[model samples]
Target: MADRLRSIAFAIFFYGLSVPIVLGTPVAALLGTSFMRGYCIAWARLGVWSARHILGIRMRVEGQRAAGPALYPAKHQAMLETMAIAAMLDAPAIVMKRELARIPLWGWAARRYGVIVVDRAANARALRQMMREAQAALGEGRSVLIFPEGTRVAPGETPPVRSGFAGLYRALALPVVPIALDSGQVWPRRGPKRPGTVTFRFGAPIAPGLARADIEARVHAGINALEP
Candidate 1:
């Protein structure tokens, strides 16, 4: 119960901070400058700090950052990583579901600040389109972030890694930076939240020249080492 309260309080606090970030991005954009991008990332990192200090959730990051301007393929455990890393890493252009673009203010805020939406329901067509968009962004020197698992897993359950991500690796041929986490235990799907420790294992970058299978293997191996 106490952890749930803490979670609620922290959520409220971050929501309070997010309002300013949403407003600031546009205000800055109106000022005829690109300052909002940095502000957006700064606000994201602050939100991450609040998750730790305010909510008592801790994150442990491992491995070295090898994918600068590369594809960041992560093991999806919860929404926390989605938000937290959006701040911790460089102003990487995000690839998320197209549905989010319909969210009230959040969609606008994220889109204006470099969020790229991929329609998950489009099946093979979605794959074809997303690659084109992702490649264009990466070519412009942006890092790509993707959840190879495709969907969130229940706590303690392992899901088959969808081939979409592997397909992405083969196509991009960019170094893969794998980030793993144990967040589901502390964060309930539809119930109260707990203040458990989560770890982000960042495997070394799969160098640009490595074989695609070898690179994907290394990424999966790193995630396998993480605790549930």
Candidate 2:
């Protein structure tokens, strides 16, 4: 209960500060393109920093940054991992849930950073939009991250990635890098949260030949193989 209160308090505080930060993104974009990448991910760094300092969570990252930008297919245990990676990765482009864009500060800031948002229920339009935005981001030499599971999974539960993921891979034709972690066990997905180490291990990039039918299965196996 103490841990939960701390985590919740930190989250609410972060959200409170985020109101003005969201509107300032447009101003940052207009300042210069150099400010663009940093502007996109700065709030993420704040959230991650607060997680570590205020809530006492630590993060470990594996795998080196390769030459070309690739797509990250990560397991969604808790939302903290995404914010942590936002600060850690080199100018990463995010593919996120469409509803997030509707939030007061986060949504506007995310769009300014070129984070792709998709309405999972609107299959065709959403996939097309995600691919289009992803291609543009890759062309600009940025990495894109997506959660194939499409939603959060509780500890010990399996995340069955939707077919929408395979379609995104096939359409984008970009390298898919799988990130496996046991973050949910530490963060506990908003229930009985505890401060501890959450490790993020990056697996090898999936080759182009990895077919659609096999993509989700491959990602699932990789995430399951991580430490429990």
Candidate 3:
């Protein structure tokens, strides 16, 4: 009961505050990407803060943070990591689905903030576009964050990464920093949130240029390293 109530309170507070930010995103965009980056980061931090205080969920991040431009293929178990990534990373260009990138005002802000939107059902052209944007982000010294599974999964489920991961890896030619987290244990894909520590374990960087099979295997193992 308490957890459910807290979850409700957290959602209300978080989304309520987001109203004004979403409305002002256009102005932020006009201020330029630099200002918008800061704006997005601030919003992400607010989410982390609310999760900690209202939902009683704490974050425990392990391993060293990656340096320079690299690829981050992370475990996707809950929405918490979506916000957490922005809060933790240094202005990374996160890869998200086309649906999310189409969410009206939020989508507008995300595109302006440099998120790389991927069409899951797209063909070679979409792949090329994704790589181009990812390369541009890397050129700007920003790491590219992607959830290889493409969508959220339940705890303990280690789904094979989508094919696009390998294509992007090959195209970008950057080291891969796999991230494993147990956010689903606390903040699930459905139902009320629970109160527990969400652990994000960052694996060591896998060097670029590995064969498609090898890279896929390594990332699959790395991102599921924390699963029981």
Candidate 4:
């Protein structure tokens, strides 16, 4: 009962503060990518702060943090990691679906902030466009973050990495850093979030140029490392 109450209060506090920031997204876009990225990062940090204080959730990152241009394929479990990564990484370019990119003012800001939008239905054409944008982001010294599973999975689920990940790996020609986390244990896809520590475990980086099967196998194991 207490946890439920805390979750409700956290939601109210967080979203209430988020209104003005969401409204300012387009204006931030006009200031250029740097300012927009910072604005987004600040909002992410705000989420982290509220989660810690109001919801009693904390984050712990284990293993080496990647520096420079690399591919970070993370486990998709909940919305927490999405905000957490933005707060943690150094201006990462997150790969999100076109549906999200189609959102009103938020979508405009995301595009201007340089998020790599993937159109799953477009197949090859979409893959090509994603690679082009990813390469451009790397050139700007930003790491690309993607959830290979494509969508959030409940705890204990082991879904195969989507085909697009390997294609992006081959196109980017960068080492892959797999991030495993069990956020769903607390911040589940549905239901009230519980108070607990969410751990993100970064596995060893796999060198680029591995065969599709090999890279996919390694990443599949890496991102599920934290799973019981």
Candidate 5:
């Protein structure tokens, strides 16, 4: 109970303090995209820092991040990985839902930070748009991080990989690096915080050009390998 309260308090404090800076992202973007990236990294690290001190949750990143341009398909088991991945990757641009891009200050910041937004319900046009944006981000030397499950699930559950991930992989023709973690065991989808170390393990990059089935199978296997 006390841990939960502390987590809540820290969230409130973080968001409250971030509003002004997030709202200012547009101005920062005018100077350079690096400015916005720096701002985002700082905010994400703050969350990680607070989670450690206040919630007593530690993070351990195993294996080195793959070099060069690649698409990162990570398991989505909790909300913590979003910020954790952002802080860990180099100039990462996340692919998030379009609706989230309308959330006032956060939306503004996301745009400034060069994050790509996709309309899940839209037709072929939306897919093309997302591909274009993602390709552009990759061209800029930013790793594109996407969650193939499309939504959070329980730690042991394995949902089918969304078609969008396959589409992006085929279009970009970049290596796909699967990231696995067990954040749900600590910062569960719903419940009090549990104190423990969340491990983020980055698997080897699977080169492109393989059949979609092979890629998906590899991704699923890689992401599910969270424990020894």
Candidate 6:
């Protein structure tokens, strides 16, 4: 109960503090998109700091952060990994649902930051658009991060990855860096966050041109290392 309260308080505090920064995202965009992107990354770090001091939730990354741009398909267990990964990576273009890119302030900031928004209902067209956006990001030397599962699942659950992940792999022809984490054990999809260290284990980059089945199987094994 105490930890829950602390977690809630930290969220409120962080949101309150970020309101001004989020509001000014457009202004920063006018100067350069990197301004807002850097701010957002810094904001993610702040959230991590609050999680540690206020909620007693720590982070333990098991592998070295990817140095250059690559296609990153990560486990989707909780929001904690989202924040932590964004903070740890360099010039990341996070692929997300279109709905999130519609929220007023955040949406504006995301656009300026070059976040790749996908319309899941649009099928192949969406994949094509995402491929274009992802290629553009990679061309700019930025890492592209996608949650292959499309949505969050419980820590022990493993859902079939959306086909869009394969689309990116096929289109970009870039090595896929699969990352696994147990963030859901600490920060769940719905519920109070528990206090613990979230571990993100990054697997070796898989060369491009593998069959879809093989890529999916390898990614599944890599991301589910934490599953019992």
Clash totals for all candidate models: 0, 0, 0, 0, 0, 0
> Across residues 55-151, which tens digit of lDDT does each residue of candidate 4 receive?
8999999997666678999998988898898777866999999999999988887888889999877677778889899999989989999999988
Q: Provide the overall lDDT of each model, using Cα atoms, as 2-decimal numbers.
A: 0.73, 0.77, 0.91, 0.90, 0.85, 0.83
The per-residue C-alpha lDDT of model 4 at residue 215 equals 98
- How would you order the candidates by TM-score, starting with the best? 3, 4, 6, 5, 2, 1
Model 6 compared with the native: what TM-score? 0.95
My TM-score estimates for the predictions, one after another, are 0.84, 0.88, 0.98, 0.97, 0.93, 0.95
Candidate 2 TM-score over all chains jointly: 0.88
Model 4 alpha-carbon drift over 4 Å, by segment = none
Question: For residues 1-228, what per-residue lDDT tens digits would candidate 2 score against the true structure?
Answer: 788788778878887777677767778878876586686567778888878887888988777544687778888888787877777676688888889888876677677778888886866766788889888887888888888888888767776787777877877777777888777877775466578888888887777657767887887776665745
Instruction: Give the better candidate number (2 or 6) by lDDT.
Output: 6
lDDT of 5 by residue, 1-228 (tens): 786787687778777777776777777778888877997888788878878887889999887787787889999988789888998896598999988999977887788788888887868989999999998998898899998888888888988888888888898898888999999999877778778999999998899998889998999888888843
Name the best candidate (by TM-score): 3
Q: lDDT by residue for model 1 over 1-228, one digit each (tens)?
A: 787788788879988878877766668666532476777777778877888887778887777666357888776767788877776677777877788878887788777776667776668877888788778777768788887666777656656555666767777778877787778777767776676688887777676656656665777666655754
lDDT of 5 at 225: 89
Model 6 root mean square deviation, Cα atoms: 1.3
Residue 135, model 1: Cα distance from true site in angstroms: 2.2
Give the 10-residue window scoring lowest on summed lDDT in candidate 6: 60-69
Candidate 1 residue 218 Cα shift, in angstroms, is: 4.5
Report the lDDT tens digits of candidate 3 across residue range 129-208: 99999989988999999999988999989889899999999999999999999999998878899989999998999999
lDDT of 3 at 110: 94
Indicate which candidate wins on lDDT: 3
Q: Pick the winner on lDDT between candidates 1 and 4.
A: 4
Return the candidate ranking by lDDT, descending. 3, 4, 5, 6, 2, 1
